[model samples]
Target: MKMTDIEKQVGDFRLRIPQLQLEDGCIHGLIGGNGCGKTTLAKLMMGILTPDSGRIDREGLTGREITMTSQRPYLMHTSVYENVVYPLKLRGEKPEESDIRPWLTRCGLWKKKDQYAGSLSGGERQKLSMIRAMILKPKFIIVDETLSNLDPDSVKLFEQWIREIQEQSAVTWVLISHQLSHIYRMSDQIHFLSQGELVVSGPARELLKNCGEERLRAFLDRESLDRT
Candidate 1:
């Protein structure tokens, strides 16, 4: 997918991107400090928000082929199993136990399958949300801070599933996170935004290791300090 001369204005902030390309089947990290239009860019890509100027070339991707999950995902007051299978049912696809059990079991939610989704812990809820997103096997997925506030064990589980999906399928992922560790570990490419501009973008390792932008360096330093 590509964006050329894209622009969107929200109140006093305006997001501008002259050109951006997301290679297919790769994990792309969208990173920046708070209020830096990272989520705006993501919303634009997901078609949740329309650009005021310029066009986004989706490379033939459709609404059904794309999905987005946020930090606080919406869940029905229904069974965990029902929550996971909701997307499938929406698409007129019948829910299959054979296809659903593995994800539930892998995410440690199989035993809670019959329990109410609202009764799960925060980490468990996030896990269920992710499972619901992944169950569709969408071609393009935008995960916007969905891993935030999870325990270490849950984070590790998420990491493992992310890597496994990348290895096994041609799914394109745009992971938006404040955690640099998650971005550096999972991203093949990185896009850094600052004050509504895409300041730097390149291979994840090279950009992180050799980034010389003052704003980016400061952000990285701040994140490191936060860790301590």
Candidate 2:
């Protein structure tokens, strides 16, 4: 559920950051500019890449219990129903229509149940990816820019679904995004990543109000300007 002095190298980028202890029962958001290593951090925590130094301390997870959704989205070459059922299948649990229907409907993917996952639109694919990731109801979720690629309407739909999930489940959500409005709307806490380092992190509301760092201020200002 945390990272301790984690370091990693990916291609030309080198990431070095201290441990991140995720708050239990809350939605945490990672916001940063492009190339700031948000996705890298998510990948490191998910064990997709080994840390070069230090460690990830996931007390409850033993590899099999973790799930992640990446920025690009990953979908199997199968029907939407099959893709939604894949996570449960991997756990050796039989896939059930009852278990899968609500999530699909919530994600706005229910009507496409029998369609090929590979044929979905970008937003639909992202929703399907989330459904697959959340089906297992893992203790923690690593969502790397999951909503970044969606259209405004799709993003709105996903946001409502997220709130519903939080209300109904005990799973902790960790999200990465460059969209300041999304972060402001969803997170209970925020982590500001800069060039692979965690520059600032604290309560989302307070940080948005009094975040002293220049970079954070600028990012917030840009969001305000864009909104106008």
Candidate 3:
């Protein structure tokens, strides 16, 4: 995927960049301080918000799908099975339990398949979001703070399932998060935003360990960050 010199204005903030280069089938991390345009950039890529200038050219994604799961997931007030299988049904396809079982099992939600979706915990709800998004097998996925509400145990489970799905489907992912540890653990490349500006982008682990920028270093060093 690629962006050619895009610019966006949201109130007083601006996100300007000359280019964004993403490798196919890799985990890309998006990190920044609060209101630094991480989610905004994600929205732009999703076309939920239009850029003020330039273009977002999704190279090689002409016939493929692009999907996103936000920090706060959208789950209907229905059974977990319904929530996970809704997308397939929406596209005039049958929602088969057999087809959906592996995804539910992968996210540790198979036992809760018949339960009410709204009754699940925050972490479980997030898992449902992941399951719903991943079942479609989109070519590209934007994960915006999907791990924010999870506990340590849930985080590990979520990461495992995510890795499994990614490996199985070979999808390119853009993960936006305030959690630097997750960014470090899962990302192949990293993009940083500061005051709505894209400050830097490069290899993930190297960016975390070697970036000399004060704010980025502080952000990387912080034990935890508030969900944005």
Candidate 4:
């Protein structure tokens, strides 16, 4: 998908992008500090928010082909199994236990399949939300801080599953997070935003080595310090 001359304004905050391209079949990271328009940009990409001025070319993809998951994903008040299979049901498909069991087992939620989704822990809920999103087999998926609740082990497992799915499908993923480590580890390309502007964008390693933008460099340094 490509965005050209995109502009959006909300009160004092204005997001502008002259030109941006999100390549197909790649994991792209959208990173920024708090209130830096990461979520706003994501909303534009998902068509949840219209740009005040500019065009977003979704590469002929429809609403059904796109999915977005957030840190606080909404789950049904029903059982975990029911939550995971809801998307399939919406598509008018009757899924078998065999179809849903693998996803539950993969996320370590098989034992809780019959349990109420509302009773699950934060990380467990995020995992269930992820499974629900993936079951739809979307062409494009935007994950906004969905990994923030997961433990290190769960994060690793989620990463492994993401890579496996990417290997088998041409799905485009956009991961929005403040966690540089997660973005650095998972993204092929990174787009750094500062004060509602795209400060830098390039391959993850290249930008890490030499991000010419001073603000972004300073932010990276601060993150490195926090890690130590």
TM-score of each model, in listed order: 0.95, 0.91, 0.89, 0.96
Q: In candidate 4, how many clashes are counted?
A: 0
- Model 1, residue 223: distance off in Å is 1.0
Cα-based lDDT for every prediction = 0.90, 0.81, 0.83, 0.90
Q: Report the lDDT tens digits of candidate 4 across residue range 50-110.
A: 9999999998999999999999999998999999888888998999999889889987999
Candidate 2: lDDT over CA atoms? Answer: 0.81
lDDT tens digits by residue: candidate 1, 1-228: 999999999999999999999999999999999999988999999999999999999999999999998888899999999999988999999988888999999878999999999999887888888998888999999999989878878888998988888889979999998878888888899999999999988998887877888888888888882322
Give the per-residue lDDT digits (tens) of candidate 3, residues 1-228. 788788999888888978888788899998887888888899888878988888888876743388999877988989999998878888778967788898788768999999999999888888888878878888899999988988888888877867887778778899987777777788899998888778888997777777788777777667453223
Give the lDDT of residue 20 in candidate 2.
Answer: 84
Per-prediction RMSD in angstroms? 1.9, 2.1, 3.2, 1.7
Best by TM-score: 4
Alpha carbon lDDT at 4, candidate 4: 95
Rank order (by TM-score, best first)? 4, 1, 2, 3
Clashing pairs in 1: none
Distance from true location, Cα of 195 in model 1, Å: 0.8
State the weakest 10-residue window (summed lDDT) of model 1. Answer: 219-228
Could you tell me how far off, in angstroms, the CA of residue 127 lies in candidate 3 after the best superposition? 0.7
Count clashes in each candidate, considering only residues at least 3 apart in sequence or on different chains: 0, 2, 0, 0
lDDT (Cα, tens digit) per residue for candidate 2, span 51-141: 9999787877777767799777877888999887877877889967887788888767888899988998887788778778877777788
Off by over 4 Å in 4: 225-228
